[model samples]
Target: MADNADRAGEIIENRLEGMLGAIALPPRTFAEPICVDCDGEIPAARRQAAPWCVTCAPCQSIRERGSRR
Candidate 1:
């Protein structure tokens, strides 16, 4: 039973590696983050979490909510 589980794990790992290799991930780009709407300083945490962010978290949330219409 243990041997079977080990083999299954190996198969899954190999498949995952192949899948990852098949995709071409985009290169990350960093921008100077500033809240366009509020002209407030965007936190480093938010910028690191979303490198392409143009606004602070609160502004972004509001923008997303407004777009749901």
Candidate 2:
């Protein structure tokens, strides 16, 4: 029934919200305009996307790949 389905959806939504609330979220942060690793300009879009980034996209990708080994 439509009512039963709606009630089920509500229950699921409530449980998800509770779980999310219990989880810790990272603190908001800002980063320097220049990339620490490459000494390049950190793009405005990149800073907006990840305000905590210390490196530009290329440097960040390289670092992540190197760390995977």
lDDT string, candidate 2, 1-69, tens digits: 579889999999999999999998655665679999989999988887788889999999999999999
Candidate 2 Cα RMSD after full superposition onto the native fold (Å) = 3.3
lDDT of 1 by residue, 3-34 (tens): 98899999999999999999976446654667
User: Model 2: residues >4 Å from true position, as ranges?
Assistant: 1-19, 22-24, 27-29
lDDT of each: 0.84, 0.89
Off by over 4 Å in 1: 1-27
lDDT of 1 at 10: 97
If scored against the real structure, what TM-score would every candidate get?
Answer: 0.57, 0.61
